[model samples]
Target: MPTNQLTAGVCSLLNEPQHTEDLLNSTPIVQILSVKKVHSNPNAPNPVDRYRIIVSDGEHFLQSMLATQLNHFVDEGKIQKNTICRLDKFTCNMVQEKRLLIVLEISVLEQCEEKIGSPAGLQIPPGDAAVTPSTANQTPAAHHTAAATGGATASTSNTTTPAARGQGARSGRGPTTFPIEGLSPYQNNWTIRARVTNKSDIRTWSNQRGEGKLFNVTFMDETGEIRGTAFNLAVDALYDKLEEGKVYYVSKAKVNLAKKQFSNVANEYELGLEKNTEIEECRDSSSFPVVRYNFIDLAKLQEMAKDSICDVIAVVKETGDATEFTSKFGRTSTKRELTVVDRSGYSVRLTLWAKNAEKFTNTDSPVVALKGVKVGDFGGRNLSMSSSSTLEINPDIPECHALRGWFDASGNSENFQSHTNSFSGAGGAATFNRSELMSIEEVKAKDLGTSDKTDFFSTRATVMHLKADNIAYPACPTQGCNKKVFDQHDGWRCEKCDRSFEKPEYRYIISMAVSDHTGQAWFQGFNELGETLFQRPANDLVAIRERDEAKFNKLVEDVNGHQFNFTCRAKQDTYNETTRVRYGVQKILPLDYAEEARHLIELLSSPWAQ
Candidate 1:
């Protein structure tokens, strides 16, 4: 073909060319240039873009072709910019100031002519050396390099090409071969250059079929990402060998539809490692990218709704006592609660029950980093922690240590408080001079209070008043409702509720008059202590008080004038729109007037306030 005729033909085929040049000396080398403008193809629905390239041969022109259909060449090592490429038969032409080219199928010349101290003028050998129609079956040297590097190699013949290996491959069928493009359909035979982003530890479970180990690992490529799992023998073979952040040429794996709700990866299907699965590490760093995240601040934790999963960084403000309880799974486990707070000006309770509690307690002033921890509520406030959640103590992350320092410097440690109340308060009290106090031995010696009004409070009292003989009958068990129960023989009646009940309740009245040098006060005890002081079972006392009022009052007065010394506390209680201060007798002692007088004198003389 004539040079101009071939150039014109190729230009017509490509629609344009940026530049064109001709060389007559030294085997008539032809050079084409000015390839700045190339329009994309509207007909190509997949890639949707096309470019026009220039081609040339020193002598005769072969044929013209479209740039979009040419194979892409990615040079590994650096190449000089605009360096002349030796073409066996090619031409550069222009359509309308745009560059166009046609490449003739020919072998690259072994030698070149010199020009300006640089190689120029592509040279071609005689007839046999030229690539004829039959020689096209020979694969290029680049194809072998690709194969050795575990990359996708183009086959010289259509029948010998490798099968596609990615998505859309039918199960049980061999791999399919396809061309490479910006976003080509993934075939079953293609090997993808991907990196191991994450790997999970192998886990085993046993059932009727058998026991086996399975673990999943996440892989990412320039094109997309997918998760793959190794089962049984694959676990032992690949679990420990797989390193994260390393690239690999992966192919021949099984592909199955993935549950969208279960995974966040972009691919609709996940990969599985089979016996014939191929994975080779890619040493090229430029082929893989790192994972990135925009972590949320710990201070924003409180603003998130309860049960919302989030990441957090906080110092351990306090550690709770480990408690063991039975779980729904029938396992007895221990757990502890820890208070964690950050600069956000709020604190949250983290329950580290069981093994976590034990492990956390061993850390020295731990600062915890939690990922995917669920916010929870305890005692009406927000809390967070998780069992399957990821937790790190004093992680290398700066936020971990920063929060620790802030918590320590802010005196947060000293302000730690329990999340729940464990004790109740006293109601009312009367003060007595120390002189009136007597020991339990003395009380037992004098036999002060009778069995009736046995309830008493006193300072310097002994266990004699606490003896079973001094206790009254039982009281109601309606939480916080401490009214005495009356026995009606058939069952019991509650004074507070004014209702009759089948079950008789127990109660004790710890009422005693305390006399101090400054003043005299009355005290009382209800519920547990009341039953204890009366020396009667709470149920029995409830029965007696309910059915036999005369007996109950007589029992109360028998201990009168006994002068049982006691101590009491006074507190305010509101009922029916009125607030009343009630007195609770704390302790009681049998009086020895002389001994009481002596103790009272000592107390009065003491420097401590009355």
Candidate 2:
């Protein structure tokens, strides 16, 4: 029995009634009599990483553990002899011959702040202490003898080594762990053992709060996955030690709602590592799952809303040439696109950014699995690797292996339909729809594209005529700029732009007469639109024209009489004081005659129709 704290004092509970025992079972106030030198492990193979302290309430004295996390408090002269502390969390467990007092958290009230009686044995009722059946080997009399000198333990030797004591144990049982899904911003005092599946590059950021470097890791277990970040000193201490696919025992982290803008993990909460966080590598990670993936099929990607972060696994049907360009923000970026397909017989585009683009190796159209790709609908449905996204080529996932096998077998024979349109900027006219659309004749009537902003409109037009000679030109191969170029002796040169390129991109700049029932207009089609119209790459057309002039003429004549739903950007330009409306095909869509007829009907029925 122990005295209750009347006012900011100390108290303890009697260890009796076995299962009903209190004290360590509940939060209490205790006074430290002396910090013990060490404790021995008579049963464990090695000593554990923990310390012992003799604590007393006004009446009873007991031996308690100084948790490894709070060892710094003792070294820093914070929790010493005669210090009174309120046990924030603690437990009492019976391990064979030892009754261990384990404290998870504590708050120091003061050290010898108030004068009281000397630390002594519990003052229980006269007969109550003597008749306790819980006292096995030690009688009530021997209990006092043990309390006077030190705790009653099986090992009286002082040979317990620090290595054995550092095993992070006190009672017989080990730390209890919970799943990541059970974690939330409101919960506390939980431990989780998980494997690091992904690790982000160390990045530094600054704001009004402060500045520091941070690295992120995706931790997953059989239950679920969550993200953990270490900052500044924690980064230097833990980053090098934490490797992907390694398991770790972590506890005492600050959990909060995850920021959707930065991560694609499904967890509602993320962890923030603190100085007191206990992270140690686990020798065995057999319990952790390999990973968790909610992969969206390539065919279903087009149905997803824009900006949604999702995962996908598909076989690479083709890969684009890598390109390096400066973004609008003045930051240089590298990019490449992959045309991927799945069993659904449908294809879509995937744009890998920065280092991923530069390091890509699309050998033999490998199966590519990506996580956290941002869905985009610039002109049509597409995918772009997000900053926090991860890319894996020919991964070992089941879907990846299946896709690889299928592509090698029957997938190559089946023609796949593309979910995306022309190329990158074909999305230039993506913002416009049937409502904002106007015919080529209406474009001329309204004097469109002359305003500061280029007027965009879609029309159902047929290629009635095309200039068979010199319909294509050699242009700068560089991405972001497709201006025409000249074939100098050494290489291709764009004299007007004052730039020379080692590789010249063959691009289409064909002059064509597009006609509709309303009227006809001249439209110039560029590389992407030209490729779509002729169903041949600009480079192929250039080669055919150079190899055989008559063959080039035949290819140009092939596109004639074919109708298409075209999205065009109109701009007026004047050369030699002869200003004319220049209609450039921004996007070339499949001719859906029924959809086109319905769209025309809507335009004609409008009140403002001419």
Candidate 3:
């Protein structure tokens, strides 16, 4: 291609505004004159990289951005400075009074030695004077408001009326509403018209600061999404006012840096609602975009890190009855396990808690769309819903319909591979596969606990001896706070809560020496695992020890020689300037001889064994 020909169409879209739509749809070719990397937060764990590129046709160069999704082009040396490329797909947005072309898709045509023609910087008109090729139903004027205004009274030069300055006015026609993507701590005087994508129940917390209640809601617009949280009085005022899937005009809320540890929203900032925050329901919300999901397939869940949040769509293959359990803090909670499968031929367990568990009655293999569910490596790979998670049963979307059709046709007949290798026992109890069983000698030989990361493995061992000294600790009774409380004579005082409780909950911290054929080693277990081993609550055991020391000693003797399958976590721990590997029991399952024999037979019959 000639250099002059490449530069001939430079700034063509700006020069020929009348044919802008036609040119944008044609996938215009351009030359990359220069590329610069944008700086991002250094404190972020995994900050996304952004690139600003100056492109030219021949006579003029314009500023452009490479979308994050297309970062692979630059990373793989496919696209760089002085490279000619075809803009396969892109959108233009008016940001900060300038036109920014965001390239979504591109193909490198040829790599050149130098910049294409002597191209000068292209100038873009402000506000509505410049026409952009964005498909979103947003105008330059509204985008200008989003970028320029910080909540002072609207300028007289704009079309906003004086009555629009206050609350109770409709959006679009009243005050100019800003985009959620444009929200930042620097901009305070802004109103946003967004739909509630997800809402969390009001939850109370107590720390050294004091006790207070808060609720969170995720809001979305055509531009982007942001999370909003209201504390105490604001929670009481706004909790009942906001409904999931409803649109509202919100303003006067403070914006702060996002806490990435808690949220999966992509925005860099979040909203803090106050007592005087204005929130009026918007009746005209048809123009707003619906809740978006970046769904990951079940087969790929294993590649993701544990505790990461993700969205997934799968078929409910099996549902378990809800079971209630009391926490160490004496708070009762309900949870149910579900076996869900997807087209990837992988099955994973999904746990639902509280109201979500109780309300889930779908038993007809309904397709479920889950958003913001947490990934866990529990039985290999599993999912659990959090308070901010969104669950849609049989959603009237194309993805749901397609999954349903696939399941009814051939998906149901396909035998899926489960993440955990388990089978049913005689009484319908779950039996673990013996293939994962590791001998105590093999564990030590592999130096499993030598690294900083914790290692998990299963083993079958007998309880050689049980330590009966200091077996339990008095923990704070507050829900979710199992910290050990100190005795302050009058009552037990919890430093974490800065409060005193009449009676502290006794939680078990069992230490036992276990032996396999290889060797004997000591292991520790907390509350849940200790309860499973003793078959009684730690509090009851404490009472028995105080009332009848003979019976408590007898109980310990009875469980001394019992053998069972134990899943344990091993990590290097340092105590008093000494470091050693410590094994902590995670799960205790009763031994099933019948299941063990079947596993042996299956293993012997395998081709590898032969």
Q: Against the hidden reference, what TM-scores do the models get?
A: 0.33, 0.54, 0.57
Q: lDDT, candidate 2, residue 312? A: 82
Write one digit per residue (lDDT tens) for candidate 1, span 245-354: 68666677766654443443434457778756877666655623554222355456535554555556777766878866434333456777777766666566677755
Give the Å shift of residue 28 in candidate 1.
Answer: 37
- Residue 60 C-alpha lDDT in model 1: 26
Shift of residue 99 alpha carbon in model 3, Å = 7.3
Tens digit of per-residue lDDT, candidate 2, span 252-363? 7787656656776665568997666888787766644666666777788767666777878888888998987544333457989888888988887789887789889878
State residue 589's C-alpha deviation in candidate 3, in Å. 18
If both were scored by TM-score, which would come out higher, candidate 2 or candidate 3? 3
How high is the CA lDDT of each candidate model?
0.46, 0.66, 0.73
RMSD of 2: 20.0
Instruction: Name the top TM-score candidate.
Output: 3
Which number leads on lDDT? 3
CA lDDT of 264 in candidate 2? 63
How well does model 2 score by local distance difference test? 0.66
The digit string of per-residue lDDT tens for model 3 on 394-415 reads 9988999999999999999999
